[model samples]
Target chain A: MSEERKPGEPANEISRRAFLAALTTSAVTATAAALSPLKDVVDLPTLEEFLRLHYKELTPEDKKAILERIAAQVEKDYGVRPNVTDPPPIPGVEFGYALNIGRCIGCRKCVYACAKENNQSRNPQIQYIRVLQMRKGSIDVESAKTDYEGEVPKDGFYYMPVQCHQCRKAPCVKACPVQATWQEPDGIVVIDYNWCIGCRYCMAACPYGARRFNFEKPEIPKDELNPEMGYLSNRPRPKGVVEKCHFCLHRTRKGKYPACVEVCPTGSRKFGNLLDPDSEIANIIKTKRVYVLKEEVGTLPRFYYYFNL
Target chain B: MTLDRDEGSKRIPLAAAGAAVACLLALAVVFTKDLIGKGPGRDDIPKLSPEYADPSTVRKVRTEMTFDGAPCQACHEGAEPLQGNPHEKGIFHEHIELKHGRNQHCFNCHHRMQPADFSNFDGSPIKLDNIQLLCAKCHGTIYRDWGLGIHGRRSGFWDTAKGPLKTQVCIACHNPHWPIFKPLKAAPPPHINPRTRAKGGKTAGAENHGGLD
Candidate 1:
């Protein structure tokens, strides 16, 4: 092939051009070969989706466009079109959650209710609430058993369900290398799932162990997908992001009680505005000596625990 | 002689300056200790909205709400309520289980003269809508807590001006006859954890979701 070079051109020049051409061709082939290995991974996110700006940085128009794209993508993937929206926080409202440790019967009704309300995955089972069956006279979460299959409200055990406390001084928010997770004005610690880089630093930073990472694509039944979704709340998240309880912002922001709070047969769960003087949580904090979990750590979790007695 | 006199004057001022510096340092140390000892100052506890009851529960219970099947006037209109256990005859009151504290007779909760309504602490006819008053006769503390909107769950808007707030009535959750709630089936426990994957376990499916019982 070298000997068959065209006549009338400088032999050295022709050889140099051929060498350069071969180098360029090989470089192209090598680049293609490298990208071929990532074909499965790179196929999901479009270039526009991958280059999307952070949630905070998005303009109204940008947000609308991004949301539409995401909704379209979700519809395509899950076979359901979710109303993924970011609703404004209610004015003069600051959310607070309380649990009556005395009344909790260890029935995980709140857990399943939360999963169903938040549109969580069923097969892989991403549950936001974990009912810790702790022994009486002990508040140590480290020793609390979560896998107890026996009759609940067991002889010596009391149930304490733990979820995202939505701390005022959220360590998870501070730990996010990317500003993906943040606290809303209503005191809900929310995650912009699309913006999370999946560093798992926030998971390590959380003292309550409230955060859950999507190890694989969250799998939900087609009919189970909640059509009502808050943009920063229960919107179906992609693989490799962190998720947690958002005080059911999707429902609560719309002037509705959280599903968990409504389903609680014993009325152990309490939620209201911390700023409001007569709110149920505030009354509990005022009248009942409400204590927070891991208070020495000073995370200032909005979740309070109290014995009605 | 002039230079020696200047040095002598400088010595007094330098000693005075040293004393002042020491005093300032002592003040700073004392203030720092005082601040540290005090810790985070009392944060202004925010005032909550006045309406604290569960909006949904309160909304669901109408003031004139009647219990299913049996009306208060059904027996109280013509016949005198039978004394002692209504179920002692074992005819119509088979479901009546007096699990409430200490009371044995039918008239403990019911008025002797007026069998149509419950009795209050003042022995007045307590309407069914104001059952809290009837419960308050014994459970004063719980009644107080309920009044403050903490003992029971509240639903609806925290801002009452925005929407109606509903509180769960005493009978909504507690059975008047039994008083104590029966334990229903709890939701499934979490099967997966941070360390479970290391042990090679999978998520609990439908077969393993419910309790062992």
Candidate 2:
């Protein structure tokens, strides 16, 4: 091969070294062009954020510093200082939610209440709860309409609000390549927004379509910003991260009812610590004809739908 | 071995420089703490005060004169008290359209003598404060569910140890005269994404009908 090359190639023929150099130059140019859009980013993470350890690795002191940094960033952006907390899951308290399909008025109050409490975006609105107006005597979710207008609890229709089930064996957690999302000890699945890589594998893997991806910077109005935020739950998520209902962990950890449960006019939504045998949720499961969404998947979802009529 | 030792010795200064840089960043975080100005703590955030609907007050608002100043005895004094469906065309309670199924008697719920109090199944007078006893006569199952905090609206803390759970009375949500729930105006549905609009305007979950038995 060396002897053949020594017989000098024609001037038009390309040498291996020139071809290799050209390929390298083109690759470098393409990479630079791809990264050029990053120059316009105004909210780039500081050195501390870039070097910060994962959520599980952070000490109490490290967490406090990080919270302070986040709070400062929020105050700068929205002009309202937020109380950001990393509330730990309560021991021996697996949360469960039950909804009375018979009692639901299809009012969608819980949906709006969740959005307001969770700081979900207003424009291109992100609601965690989707109240399906299902036809009476039919459990078909595909035929259920979400955009039904006028006064609700319409004749021959029942409403079923769907949100994160916080399954015991969550598919979203398994699909996460980076392990950014995981189920807490309390059976509430949460996501570390900072660690999410925007691949949206979890979104596609979710059977309930419970996961929502932030395609743009979340646009919450200044006055409407929920000052109380949970780090793994409702804190203002950055662009390009997946978010879903976390059972309002910030409030639930503190023993308050979830915003949806509180705002439900028909008393359709029920929530309680499942471990407590005497709790309302436990009693409902034991007494009522409870049905889990997609129960065939064997996800063992904490959210249940039942009829009391 | 000598070359490897030389390389190791060269890398030590680089490692030291990296450590120094990390220490400087830690120092910067510590120094900038005051500049961040101590954002609100969990306690600093305002607590959301839950509103509990008072059943008696709601009933008073609904009846307008039943509990405010006019008592039933004011008109029935020394006269024969009208019984069995007081919702006559010219009667005082003509506005109360009694649509409650199978419950068509006035004395069945309301005390015949006292008029202000409710009647238990045994005809014992149940005060307005104990209205659940009156409701429990016919709605035994619902009363049982309500006692377990499943049938009615409960606000405030889920954990009774942490805070009080205010369970709404049946009368707060349902009118005793006409116990059926009226339909309510629903809040708006979610805004549809433009991208979804571009794809023939199908909302999420509208297409997924698989595996549902």
Candidate 3:
């Protein structure tokens, strides 16, 4: 049986060719493996992570398992065990935000508060909120200086802080080819880090530039990681994923206002249930000359801006 | 002799292959080690508990007219009526520069008889805490707006069922003396994005927000 040959070619020659072929393949593989950039030996995902299901497709058991795996990983890596869970959207609720441009003093208290609340990466400065300093009597966001570090509320400038509007018709959701992002029933746009391919198409599609891509692994200090994380919100994200404000669903779902809304000293920020007629935001929309950013684009953003007459 | 030479030549590729495999295995080991010790550190970070706004703690909008802790009566009771130009710096009150529009006379809001408290047009004394009532006499719409959480800033649970809604007093943002919001120091703007960095001024493209557009 060992000596038998099926082809016209000599069996000895064929066997020699096969040996050479196997050696070459192994050699190539070895060389490629050696040449690969193995930065931080622990960069490879564990088996469970590699096979994790998409957020939308996850079954209850899958979610539980995946969540546990993530928690264990977080504990192992950060030394602090986190409860990474997703609370379902509340019944009879739709979140809305409003900014009173008249009263916003341009102090970035809300900005720092958000960064701390969400455990944003600090070294490279990934801020979810960009408070644009626009010239008075102007609405042009393009010319609005977001990086102005000078004294705020400049004589001719008004501050307008922008974040994810959590649009009812979110362009980010539409831009995600893999369906990794979507608008929740409560009008919050969320991303599943594990599912995101980091194509950055959503970043490009967003007119407001709300989405942020993790260019490198987020370097949150050990004690700074917010242990209370939501599955689709502030759970510690890995490198190569897109993240943005989820209206602080982790806190909001638990009957808390977003950190930004809470920390606003001037009370310029407002958040409430859009479905509730008596909510503050509802009243503003009903009576005040409220406007949405880029309304012509028809994004139907839940965020509103109103001037005090 | 020829066979010996062929065997010696074959050792080179074999040796090279051996070295390559060894290097790959070494890399795999190093990656594993890095994961165990160097990845997400065990260093402790101060954990921040999720914060919820409590409406009960919110302060009512009020003005800080006097920095002097003494009751208004302590200084104004026996003091002679402010005689010189009321607008000029007074001997007793060095810092009271009245900048509020039109109603600059001290007697306008302050009760002339009971100088300790604010007053309405009817000359009835209004408690310092109830100053909003006096302001409402002039700005009815603003009062209504404040009551509805539309005119001023507030913090706390939006859903009353969940928690109370806190709000700022009128004086929280505007100085009663000045009654005007002065320019404030703005926070640092966002870092320049690659696109914005490449282009000179525009954040995105040909988009304008000014009413001029």
Candidate 4:
């Protein structure tokens, strides 16, 4: 084949080898140039994070190490040492929330309180609760307004504040491609932020429109950072993850009312263990004209909306 | 050619029908003027009374008066205790606006003789500590709800086994004189993102959106 080359053509063996070498050099250089932007990425996962196992698969020792790493990262990022813990769900306790639609004044106190407690982004705000001001005669949420100004409990209109229903049949959990989110034994739906791939599949799956995607790095002020953080609940979430109301699991798991419940001036918000027969939530469910948001969809939400009258 | 002419002629009746329907709708709207936008107006809705017997203010006054060891008796010891309506202008306690519906008599709630303690239905002295009993006289359902941790604010813990739960007294949230809760200035609305502006310049998911985005 080399001897049969045209008069102007080089020897076949030598020319072919040189051409192959030139192609590889160009390919390597192009690849290096394309990856050059990666150098500016300050939050690239460390080796431990890259090799981390799934939340369920992590051993006790692995969890401890990971928690410590998270604490350190939070400290470095926000200049505050967060007390992060992964509290297991209390046995025989299925958490439930009850809101009195009759009494809710649409003050949005709960909305702000939740944001403060959860360390949600301030600039591009990410509040979990949306208080819809609806006309009194109708239950049509589609025509309700959220951005009403001035003093609330507007005449001829009632406020219906909606948050994560923490559905027993959570569509978000089922839609998560990586199983990063799931319902806890206590019936609170939680997310493993570290494991989330930010595909936003869960956001699309949620019927309540409860899921919020972090389009930019969450801008929580250092002073406003909730130091009492839960590993699976309100720990500072990284950019490109989906978050929703975790029922303030950090506080709720430890037997405290969620921040929203605590701040409600009208005493419209009620929360307690549904399993306990004498609990306030149980009483509200048994006595009041109880209803849930979007009941037709069959989410079986633990959150109950009720009328006192 | 005949079919084309027939199709063209059919369009005129359809246009007339459309015009007739539009005229009917316009007339219907004119006739239904009162029905449209007939919701409760600002004037029709009862204004929240400005007189609020703020629990803190009441506490402050009680403490200041009792600081000298004798409360109302300090002043009333020598002088004759004036009777009749306590809310009348120029009366000693005229500033206390009795806005609580229908329970007008001052001695109905307050002890006429002692003036320091609350009065039960039979005019017996009820201690200040048992304020729920006083409010429970009229608001029995609220009293029941408060006991079950449904009506009023609860703090500290939801699980009694794990921690202590503290339920606020009725007086802590509502004033005894006014009784009704004062209207609160609502917190600022959620920040609207510029990118998600839907039609009418409202946030895309402003209603029932649960602050997604």
What tens-digit string does per-residue lDDT give for candidate 3 at A63-97?
89888988988899899999888889999999999
Give the per-residue lDDT of model 3 (tens digit) for B133-207.
Answer: 878888899999888887766666666677886666677666677777664454444443322223335353222
Give the per-residue lDDT of model 1 (tens digit) for A229-290.
Answer: 78888888888888999988977887777888877767888888888887788888888878
Task: State the displacement of the C-alpha of residue B10, model 2, in Å, after optimal TM-score superposition.
Answer: 53
lDDT of 4 at B17: 46
Predicted candidate 4 versus true structure: per-residue lDDT over B171-212, tens digit per residue: 767777887777677776665552443334344365334335
Q: After superposition, how far is residue B71 of candidate 2 from its true place, in Å?
A: 3.2
How accurately is candidate 3 docked according to DockQ? Answer: 0.21
Q: What's the alpha carbon RMSD for model 4? A: 17.0
Model 2 spans with C-alpha error above 4 angstroms: A1-37, B1-69, B78-91, B195-213
Give the per-residue Cα lDDT of candidate 1 at A240: 87
Q: Which has the higher DockQ value, candidate number 1 or candidate number 3? A: 3
Candidate of highest DockQ: 3
Please provide, for model 2 over A1-309, each residue's C-alpha lDDT reduced to its tens digit, 9 standing for 90 to 100: 122333444444444444444445555554554555567798687899889888899999999998898899899999999999999998889999999999988877777778888998766467788888777887888777778877878989888888999999999999999989999999999999999999999988888989888877888888878999989988898999999999999999999999888877778889998999999999999899999999998888999999995
Predict model 3's lDDT versus the native.
0.73
Candidate 1 C-alpha error for residue B129, in Å = 2.3
B44-154 in candidate 2: lDDT tens per residue?
212221231111212332332263368767765524556555445345665667778887777778777777777777767898777888888888999999999789888
Candidate 4 chain B lDDT trough over 10 residues, lowest sum: B52-61
Clashes of each: 19, 0, 19, 0
